[model samples]
Target: MVRHMDERAGVDPRRTDELWLRESERYASTHPRCLQLRERARAHMPHGVPMSWMASYFAHPPVWIDEGHGAHFTCADGIRFLDTNVGDKSTFCGIDPEPVVRAVQRRVAAGSQFMLPTRDALVVAEELARRWKLPSWQFTLSASQANTEAIRLARHATGRRKVLTFTGNYGGHGDEMLTAFAGEGRLSYLGLTPAADRDIDVIGFNDVGALERVLAAGDHACVFTEPALTNEGVVLPEPGFHDALRELTRASGTILLLDETHTLICAPGGLAEKWRLEPDAVVVGKAVGGGLPLGAYGMTAELCEAFERGESLTGRPGELATGGTLFANALSMAAARAALTEVLTPDAYKHASALGAELADRLEAVVAEAGLPWKVQRLGPRSGISFGGRLARNAAEADADEQPELNALLRLCLANRGVWEAISTAGPALSVAATRADVAAYVAAFREFVTDVTGTG
Candidate 1:
């Protein structure tokens, strides 16, 4: 667990609280259009948004987005947001990148789906193999689907029923994965699943002891994790954390599954390649489809051979090496192909990384100069600033000291300052577009919000 160095260094906690509260009130007062959208949306949307997670923010009602272009979003009120959230990091190359759009348009005149795999799927699979160093690939509709499918395949290959994961990670809404640990202990979310059997085990990301204990059990099919658990406020890995993890999983005879849904912002081949960490399977979705719904799991040659030379005697109807009809629909394949071949280049990433780094550095400078108790964490092109000290590790780190009320206010303060992003924008695998002016505006917004909240020059 990473202790809050800021807290250990004796930063004042109450100062953080007061500043965030001030920011929140200022935010609510300025966004009447968002409030109106929330009201209209509530009549139809179960939680005032299509997805319940959208409503989890401190804003009682969330801002409604109208449309997006290269790197900007216009809200219902026509105010342009810097587009940091980018539909939850699904817009990796920035929204509707021209090549991807053209690809989609050209494919749309032909068809949307055929229930038969498309030729673009072949191209995508080949490019994925070339880039990710995996010989085989399969597609699904979402990251959750890909993650669960990878788990099932790993279990089927090993003849193990149990799955293992880090304590605070989200790998889609898979039944075995929708569990979280808290003040009491592990429990199911939305009562979706019962603890029929503890088939899944949770360990802290950087905790070697906890990981060793879980892996040594020898019954788990795989250890699934993000390179860093950026989902819960960008908990970066310790030095050599992933290398040790790779070694341990190999020694323990368990497969390592890396979920790159959020880390695509880090590298073209995702965080796995950036760190030179090898895993048995990699599930990457989000940006692969270029703002469309697409998911894929890439695996090594032996895994491909396992499917090819499987136990015919033990084969079941819905066994491993399985997929659905619409797995690689034409439109999704077209976008995926364009995104990989054209948009996701090293140059694109270098441009984004520079802007993101500048924004993060500016945010840290502003907060530190103000003597605020908050801290910022960044990975690749994404970054998030927390109102409390540095988060430790996973959910436990979140629980111990974070004041959500403060974070809520901070997000509002930011929105009020014309910076529209998810509160966890920095950590949620998002990036501002490469344009320096947009990046500068985002920095200006944060600085203004901080100055407003702290009531200092």
Candidate 2:
């Protein structure tokens, strides 16, 4: 017998897989153009896309997009969608915001890049310092680069060989930050030498006692983390968690490195401002560039001084992990300056926060009314829906509560009705351009899906 969608506990694995396959087949059948493109492109690319993860994101081939603008994009097959995923928060200000577009256009006409430096770079750096309350800043081409460089800086300043990171929290694709705590104190790593793996210490998020105990060893150089957990699920920090994190790291002389790529949705100044977190170093990317690729790492006064003083942990000069040739390129600097000063302003955040709350509240109401075992949560302009009723306290709980089959079914349902969300997490990020109607449309589609799946309409 088929089970109700809301029946999650002790769910039949085979049934879930079957349901996902059904939806996947349906998606492929409807989009013949997508299928044709997929076959044709496979001759050159491994999975008919530039990236392999794109193919793995959906059970079916990824949808091809023709054009995108504020809050929406048209698929290659001509289907338009309310894009809540917002390029995984890479376009949180909205696709092609006029300010960013004009900045790029104007700068490109003047010049795109110059290894020496550009005036826009200084302006962007100053703006970031003002927003984040940090004194020194450096630019990179991506968040991964920023994070990797931050770790190197932390090690150089502290003269330590090991790094501490929470399980299920992703810092970036850097080899050192690519490890996860696989529950029960077991750690797993990817594409790193055993020596590099050992330098990474994995622990559970929100476990203050565990964090303190680990740092007490005095071998860790830094604790890299997102202010609030995301991707695996939106597990928020428990009360007093940030305070404890700050206290432990400071006492142990471990640099606190925060990756705000996703948690930038927490507020105008990101989670650091919202929660009043004072990390030694901070990394930001994604929407910071307003669609252009850019990343930045900011440092406190002491950390900056340490780097300049050549205070390497091992008595060796620190390598230049800070930037690349195109890091502070003219075009990216102009785009970032425009995004920070004009597009992602206080007014835009106000709109985004309200819409985020509206989407979360409406979805939660639907679940509550239907008496389903589901919950919705919002962090400023970001929101997520999870399977269990109560919020997850940590990554382990969040992982256990995930409903992949439900996620696939809902994704397909929403896509069919003109909504698009992040496939990895099914999280929605409200853009500055998102309207009340967009939120309403998504909520209505979700309500319809819940009623249909649960047979409670």
Highest lDDT against the true fold, candidate: 2
Using alpha carbons, what is the TM-score of model 2? 0.94
Error of 2 at 214 (Å): 0.9
- Residue-level lDDT of model 1, residues 56-98, one tens digit each, is 7544357777888888777777777766776677887778688
- Whole-model alpha-carbon lDDT for candidate 2: 0.81
Q: With candidate 2 superimposed using the best TM-score fit, by how many Å does residue 395's alpha carbon deviate from the native? A: 1.4
Give residue 91's lDDT in candidate 2 (0 to 100): 93
Deviation (Å) of 62 in candidate 2:
0.9
Residues 1-457 of candidate 2 have per-residue lDDT tens digits of 2334445633344655664666667777667887788889999999898887678776556788889999999888888899988887889989889999999999999999888789888998898888789989989889989988888888888888788998877777766666543433434544565455668878888999999899998889999899988777687899999999999998998999999998886677799998899988899998889889899999999888876775475667645456689998999999999999899889888899999898899988988888776778778887878876668887777776766667767777777778887766648788998999988999898887776566555
Q: How close is each model in CA RMSD to the real structure?
A: 3.7, 2.6
